[model samples]
Target: MEIIKINDFNNHTLSESDIIKRILSGEKELYEILLRRNNQKLYRVIRSYISNTAEIEDIMQNTYLKSYEKLYQFKHHSSYSTWLIRIGINEALARLKTKSKVLHLNTAQNLNSNSILERPDTSQLNPESKIIRKEAKQLLEKTIDSLDTKYKTVYILKEVEEMSIKDIANCLNISTANTKVRLHRAKHMLKEKLFEITTNVDIFEFGFSKCDDLTEKIMSIILKN
Candidate 1:
């Protein structure tokens, strides 16, 4: 269960490909670095499909496991992050299909109560502004939770992950134009959904502590196999 400390690596600026090469060259611990780096992005993608925190963590583990198993198949045609995220999105969608869910949005318990949302650096702002922003973010989170699964998935991938339309289309197995269409529709839907709430907000709330725990859990599973 021992974790690799950050200071263990002398070269802190290794690229993703460099790290992947090292891991493939028998430096298994280096894999954890990638996990820690991308866990939040993967978690947010998975969370868009899954409402339950525990289930999201489980799928995150599966995503990492699958990616590791198929690492050899990853051609360096795209960035490592994009390749990793394509696997994550596919895994999340597969899990979504397994649940007995209707085409409509499925409601679940609130994940926001735990407050994993990363607060923007507000050092200069007064406490009152921070409180207002927090409330606004919570409202936006709730509204996103209410979006239909398709729209929600597209929205999270486009907005939260900041993935290109072409990448999103490739990841989702849809045409690029179709991907743009969905993204446009999702934006309009979100506007209508949040019209009453007059606060600009960010999406996706993965805490560092929770992300670290999940990364460790995923690594433990990977090491076992």
Candidate 2:
């Protein structure tokens, strides 16, 4: 096989710090790998806070671009994924803050209600199985969505993203004990036994097509710089 291009993804061994150094030193294309690597986790983290698809994509784009702009300042104190997740969380929360203010000003009527969960395309499954799986997924998503913002975020990070408690604490800038408390509270609020059944379900999926489109949009902008 030909040697990998400067922009191509190759070895799995290089740490994100190594890639960031190279990107800073002038191999900017490598940034695409970082974007792709963290896209799903970042998307899920943001999705747990915000349900609007358009706004989620906007925040994802801004997070990728903002991270690239501030890449030089990354201190390596945490994994790049953690750092990026923190940025995505901040952006989503900020958007919500601004939105809350707008709603407060307008005292608007009820806003549009659109579902963020993707309905499973169960073409191969029998009708009965399809109905069962779909309802279960909806109920699970709604249950998780019912959580307060603080608890929902920690819950998604711990249960859905499969992150450790310490990592979740670091990302949220909370103490380990606080992280554990929030997670415990979240599980309790979700009710017992629900977590067990929903363990493997992919709730707010960032589909491959959606990911590629977002990645390319950001990549195109990066390459232009």
Candidate 3:
């Protein structure tokens, strides 16, 4: 089988509407546009909840298949990218549930309010302090992995994806207020997780730069495609 490089997808010249029209009219190649456009975002989102590389790949492929199958039902009320992300989240959660059972993991009780309140303070720190911060970040990642599916999804969408609360609400089919609350709680949970590792450290400094780099790489790849 010939592998498709997302960088080679030609969505730059065509508007999303035009691509959707083509896809609806049986232009299979146009589907590549959607795949390329959202693959990295989907991958990042899935990776937050899925540690197993094989399962992550399987869920991502399944998400695309589901998106393609449900294309006709898309009303275009929001961008197709948004719709695709919703599908990806659903697929990721479903896969996580199955994997949780197999691994005998209980993710529901991970985000406790008392735990967050007891976390350390890391709002200000020097660059030289990154070594300790890096270890703390690993602890944070593990804690985030322990959160319930709902909270994890909200955190990944809001923090990692940098999506607005309104956008997250639409994507998750939930209320804006709920999305805000979930995000707040998720941040608190992350702080608690990091606190256990280091008393005083900067958490955001570690991941945001890496995420920015990844975003730039994805954009460069898309433009090249």
Candidate 4:
């Protein structure tokens, strides 16, 4: 199939309806536009669950393939990006199940609780300052990575991805109430993890300074492939 040049499709002007119509009318190349548009977001989504770089790429590819195969079944009730997120979540979950990776919900909850106590105070600094904010953001990401998959996915979706709880519920195929509960628990776990990391150990000494950077490296490697 010919790949569409997604970089050329300006985000504000790209019409999902038009893309769907094109794909349904035997323009398979149009699907690449959707893939490219959603790839970074989906990569972040999948990475929250699967830490292994190779496995994340594999799942991402599988998600797009599955989405293409099921395109005819899409009813257009939700946005195409939302539908794609659902497919990505399902693909990740299926792979996790096959690999027998335990989610360890309780562990995540515990870690979040620790984060709150460990978080550094930047209240006196200019929140608008880019350099300070960058350091603060990196600290926040480190705490996030310490969370278990269950909490990590919800937290990343709700916080990092800025998705609504309703959207997250649809992506996870869980009720909104459950999503809220998991998010609450995940937050507590992240707080706990951060608290432990900050109070008990030197982050530099532990070599965790590179945890946030690892995701970018992983993404670079995937794109290179």
Off by over 4 Å in 3: 1-13, 96-140, 200-225
Per-residue alpha-carbon lDDT of candidate 2 for residues 45-89, written as tens digits (9 for 90 to 100): 887778766888899999999999999999998889899999999
lDDT per residue as tens, model 4, 1-225: 434465666454558887888889998777767877787778888877766667778999998888888888987877777898888888888887876666533323222222221335656655345444555666776667777677888888887677899988888888999999999999888778777767875655634424546667899999999
Tens digits of per-residue lDDT for model 3, 1-225: 233356658446667787787888877887888777777667667766666667667988998998888788988678777788788778877876786789776444342221211235567766535545654455566677777667888897777677788888988899999998988888888778667645646545555555666788999999999
Top model by lDDT, which number? 2
TM-score of 1: 0.74
Give all candidates' CA lDDT scores: 0.74, 0.79, 0.72, 0.74
| Tens digit per residue, CA lDDT, model 1, 96-190 | 77664755545556564533345458487675566667767777787887787677777887887778888777777789899888888888988
* Model 1, runs deviating above 4 Å: 1-12, 101-106, 114-119, 196-225
Question: Which sequence of candidate numbers ranks them by lDDT, best first?
Answer: 2, 1, 4, 3
Sort order, TM-score high to low: 1, 2, 4, 3
Q: With candidate 4 superimposed using the best TM-score fit, by how many Å does residue 207's alpha carbon deviate from the native?
A: 9.1
| Deviation in Å, model 2, residue 108 alpha carbon | 12
Q: List the residue pairs that clash in candidate 3.
A: 7-225
Cα distance off (Å), candidate 1, residue 197: 5.1
After TM-score superposition, what is the CA distance of residue 109 in candidate 3 from its true location, in Å? 16
Comparing 2 and 4 on TM-score, the stronger one: 2
RMSD of 4: 11.4
Native-referenced Cα lDDT, model 2? 0.79
TM-score for each of the candidates: 0.74, 0.72, 0.65, 0.68
